[model samples]
Target: MSIRLGLQIPNFSYGIPVADLFPAVKAQAREAEAAGFDTVLLMDHFYQLPGLGAPDEPMLEAYTALGALAQATERVQLSTLVTGNTYRNPTLLAKTITTLDVVSAGRAILGIGAGWFELEHQQLGFDFGTFTERFEKLEEALQIVVPMLHGERPTFSGKWYRTESAINEPRYRDHIPIMLGGSGEKKTFRFAARYADHLNIIADIDLLPGKLDVLRQRCAEIDRDPATLETSVLLTVILDGYGAPSDIGEARSGRAVSGSPEQVADEIKRRVLDVGIDGIILNLPTHGYTPDVITKIGEALRPLVDA
Candidate 1:
């Protein structure tokens, strides 16, 4: 399959006024769709981090933002980069996603992970358990979500959650693709290989092959087909005017896919051929999500792979 591209809207607490942010977000979503991106993702968070801005800042709720995007765009899929498992009950999360999928015309994906950001959870009065306990909670949440998506009444009693025959209405027309986000070698990758339709890993081109090897080994251990899982990387991109290789700064080196269109295209080819990534989610740092960059990349690289 040809590589799919996605756009990640980083949930930075905007120092700019909300009046400016809303229009920019809508415009960017529309621009991404017009650029032929396969998906658009939002980060799930309640409070904004320090240095980025204030604590109780202009952070938009993930589901509500997605609902707005569902009405605004027609083609691009909408999802959280990874929703915190402890944020909401699985049944309710499933129903919320079902509603989004229906409204978006079957363009919703569930990207979920074990809850992280201890400070946020602690401040928000949610349980911040041990790492193992959190993963256990995530596994249970998956059990609830998967069956509920299949139009079944799910009942579960687990360490972190108890649902009494929860039923989901307005059945989804298609199976909402489940995307597991994380690179934990032991538990996270194993869970992705076992259950997820797709997997999201951090964009470290050098470490990708090793990670894939680990994922394949885990898949083998569970007798799962490794190729069944679609692999994607979340890349932070910084597009700048073409410069000499020696002029590149260390800070921008691996943190982003910078340089000219040809240089970026070459890097993408390396990720596919050398690292074996199936897709990439390009995250622009600022509100500089221009359609030109997308067109340039698409023009340069999209035709090379057999779709």
Candidate 2:
């Protein structure tokens, strides 16, 4: 999966009425594809996130939205940035992605991790367990999901998940790329070394070089080439219409940066790519879902990472 540049549509409130919601979503995706983004992503949650908006804000179900996106576009890869493992049964999640692959002609990416978002779990009736338990659940989930994505029928019983010969038919390819998104070295990095095709670093930028080194060690210990697993970082940027910044100091927090396309790209090159990360995923958080914003950001970002 050579997705060096990705666009994440995390907000659904387009200031339009409900009937025009999905039409707007499809339009942004098509524009991004034309503007040179390699992948398209959405958040996997029932409610809007805390920093973004109210709990009742409009948010589409990830798979359903991706399915609609599949019919609307031809080339851009579609996925959630990371799926919440607790939201669905492991076997069912595997089936959904495979079905997506069949529909999109093999452009689905299974981006999953230990489920976060406590309020969503409480309101939605999914169990919100301790951190260790969530990782344990993620570990068992991969046991079932990995093989099924490979078109295998294996019976496995674990404390968290049990599958009796789960088989996913009509698979578009022998493998759908699995991207594990998080910065937990003990659980997420180890799992990535073993199972993931992409590791999206979600931690602070200054600490990333150390994390990358640790990930290399994790790969080496497991007898896997560090280079085999691809990497990307998620950045929150407030883009200007033109590719220049109003003020760049607001981005010092390192995780979320604010700037125009050029400023954001320079920061990404300095912090993420120069530190040996491969790709970049941008979240506009507020001003996204507009065609011109998507096109302008992609125009500056695609070449920076592609270089």
Candidate 3:
């Protein structure tokens, strides 16, 4: 999937009552679909991340939410911004995403990463291995996952995972697109070139061009055309009319796009797209749940991404 302009719903802490949460999520997905967004994404985490909110803050499981969202909206693609590779067995993940693709009628993108978030791993009793170990696990996971998604039964044994002719059935498509998220020029970039259909670069705005250069080099190492892998950046946006400027912290402002919708669009063009990045995915963690705000943001940014 070529995600020119995507909306990621990274926050779920609207002040509304608990019963209203899924309704709020549905509204955001429906509004994003209506406003010409190509995809809608959720974070794949058991708890909220550090910059977003406290760990106790409300967060829904990604696959369950996306399954429900598949029924709630039409046309827009669905996925996690990046599923933590450490969360589930590779075979199970393949089954889950293939099920999502079937339910969403072939609009599922498997966005994944080498899992981080040490606290979640600690509290949830997951193995938080060393950084190098995590990448190694991720590489092994992909070897099984990519084949399973392609309607192949792969019998594999590895350091971290093992699968015996694992079968994934009821697939909506012969292949579901895989998008790898990260800025690692060594491991992530090389893996994206090797197996992924898209690469969502997660780095500072200033560092993007250099990252892109290294990504090309990685692709060249494998003799793969860089264009075969689509690229995008994730932005934490604070629209001017939605909330006060102080809602954003000083640290995040370096990567955030905060301004009027028009100005936000302009800045994204100058900062992300003009840097030779293919597209952008925005998350308004503080204010995007409001349907009107989602519509406005989508209206302003849609033209920039439309071919």
Candidate 4:
């Protein structure tokens, strides 16, 4: 398949006056499905970013949101952009994903990473460990989670996590794709090369080619086929009537594929051709989720893949 296009639903309540945001969330999910988007991702955050608002301001639990979206949409795959590994116990997380997969009929993608955002971690009383410790915990968590998903009784006694004979029974029909999210060369990409079925990276169009090259090298070192590891980009799109910048040059801020549909499509095509990326997860603020932008993107971009 050609590159897949997905949407990331930012969790902020962008001035949409509503007692509840669930309906808006559902509306965006429906729009993604209607727009021929491949996946719809939700953020896993307990608080709005500091300047934005309060701790409990306009946020939805990731798993709960996914379950709701499971009931809402028919085709678009649902997942978190990356769940914080420190948020839940690995065993429970495995079961949760298995349940979500079953509910979504095997359309759940588990994108996980070592939890960052020290402020949130501290406030929530989740252990905001040293960076090295967090990485170690993440590695152990994956070891436990991946095997359990495959119906294996996982046993591990790492420094961070100790589990004994924990099993996830009646695994889903298809193995849920494990997507590792991060661009750390030493530990993140290394783990992705070893275990991930897909890799999510944030990249400007300029940096993408180099990052892909590094990933390929890592894959080779691990005796893994780079091509087998599906590459995906997380992009932020700011679509206004004024149109995007005319410069078709390198991207900054790790945000690529922003602009008018034609301009965005051209950038996307370049990324696919040069870096072999198979999918893009577009991050849209609430304003950018308007039907006009969605329709324009779908009409201008879907043919590149569908054709």
Candidate 5:
């Protein structure tokens, strides 16, 4: 499915009581849906990232939050922007998404990546292997995940994981869309070329055009149409009234879009969509899901995707 315009709720620190956290999260998702956003994304991390806040800050479990979101909202799609593959067994993770699919009436999308957060692994007892190991594990994990999502009982023996004829029952749809997020050219692009339904590029803004080109080349090498795999980018946005901050789009070494809602939408079209990426996923890390801002963005940006 094409994720034309998506909202990513990367921060849950709304200064509310712990009991009210899910409501606050739902407010944003609902607002985004009203604003015409097609998908709602949550980060799949146990701890806050260094760029957003201290690791000890409030971070809800992603799938649980998504399950809750599924009950609370009607139409918007639900998923993690990209789950760290090292966090769960391939089989169980497949089961979880299947359950989410049945529960949400086929709204779940599996977005995964090679694990990157070392501290989470160190503290949580998951093996924090080298970069190579993580990708290998992700590769092996997909072998089980893809088949199971398609209603197959896959039995595989690999360097990292082995599944003994795993089965996922009660599927709402046979083909749950797979989106891979990362910037690694060799592994991520190749695997995405072969496997993913969408590719959410996690990289600097200036780097996107090149990434798109490489992605196209990768698809060509696989004898697949590049357009067949939808593409998007993850960006942070901070608005200054209805205009851009002077340093807007100055996010190569560092990344973010600080602008008025109209400007940010225009910049996305010019910088991202014009550069050939299919869609955009935005994160309002600093603003914490302000409703008006989300709506304004939706009103200004949705047409671009629809057009």
Candidate 6:
């Protein structure tokens, strides 16, 4: 499934009442859908990211929020921007996404990555292993998850995980789309070529063309067609006159696009799509909770993706 013009709701600290938090989240999702976004994603973290807010800031559980979003909206795909593999067991992750697919009538896309963020692990009791170790775990997880999504009960044993005939029933579809997020040419790109249906490259804008070339090489090495693996970039957009922070541009130099809606669209086309990226997933970390801004951004971006 292609995520052309996807909206990622990465911020939950709306400074509103706790009880009314979800209503605000629902509004964003509904507006994104109405404004022609094809997919809506949430970050899978127990705490806010380092740059986004303080650790204690309000952050909803990702799958729980996505499930709730499944009920709140009729269209638009639902998923995490990329689930941290360290957070859950591989077989369990398979079951969880399949359950989401069932709930959303087959609108689930399993976007996963070798999870970063050490504080979450230390605080939450998950083992934060070395970088190489994390990639090993992610590869093993994919072995278990990809098969389970396709209705095969995989019985496997690995250094990090083990499963015995794991079954994921009540599937809405026989297979769910798999999306890998990251720009590591060695591990992430090779795994994407081997296992993922889509790849969400999270590199700097100037590096995208080179990343795409490496991704193509990865696919060639695996005897897979590069076109079969859809691609997208995650862009931070702070529209003009939307309470944007003064330092956002410098803070997110190669990963953000800002200005009037038209200018934002032009920047995205030039910086991302023009470089051969297939699609874009935008998150308004500073001003996303405002529904009108979401509508405007979606209106401006819809044509580019649709074209």
lDDT of 6 by residue, 28-120 (tens): 999999999999999999998876778898999999999999999999999898999999999889989999999999899999999999999
C-alpha root-mean-square deviation, each candidate: 3.5, 2.6, 1.3, 3.5, 2.4, 1.2
Encode model 4's per-residue lDDT on 52-108: one tens digit a residue: 345676777899889989999998888887888999888988999898998888788
List model 3 lDDT by residue over 1-307, tens digit each: 7899899988798888999999999999998899999999999999988887789989999999999999999899999989999999999999999999999999999999999999999999999999999999999999999999999999999999998989999888998999999988889999999999999998888888899999999999999999898999988877777654355352275568778899989988888888899988988876737668878888888888884
Candidate 6: Cα lDDT at 3: 93
Report the alpha-carbon TM-score of model 4 versus the true structure.
Answer: 0.90
Candidate that beats the other on TM-score, 2 or 4, i.e. the better one? 2
Better candidate by TM-score, 5 or 6: 6
Clashing residue pairs in candidate 4 are none
lDDT of 5 by residue, 1-307 (tens): 7798899988787788888888889899999998899999999999988767788989999999999999988998888988999999999899999999989999999999998998899998989899999999999999999999999999999998998888789799989999999999999999999999999998888999899889999999989998799999998877777333243222323447767778888888888889998888987776765668889888988889999
lDDT of each: 0.76, 0.87, 0.90, 0.77, 0.88, 0.90
Task: Provide the TM-score for each candidate, comma-separated.
Answer: 0.89, 0.94, 0.97, 0.90, 0.95, 0.97
C-alpha positional error of residue 236 in candidate 3 after TM-score superposition, expressed in Å = 1.0
Q: lDDT, candidate 3, residue 30?
A: 92
Candidate 1, residues 67-116: lDDT per residue as tens digits? 99999999889999889988988988999999998999888999899978
Location of the lowest summed lDDT over 10 successive residues in candidate 1 = 242-251
Off by over 4 Å in 1: 1-3, 12-16, 49-57, 242-255, 286-301, 304-307
Name the runs in model 2 displaced over 4 angstroms.
241-253
State model 5's lDDT: 0.88
Q: lDDT rank, highest first?
A: 6, 3, 5, 2, 4, 1
Which residue runs of candidate 3 sit more than 4 Å off their true CA positions? Answer: 248-251
Candidate 1: the clashing residue pairs are none
Residues forming the 10-long window of minimal summed lDDT in candidate 4: 243-252
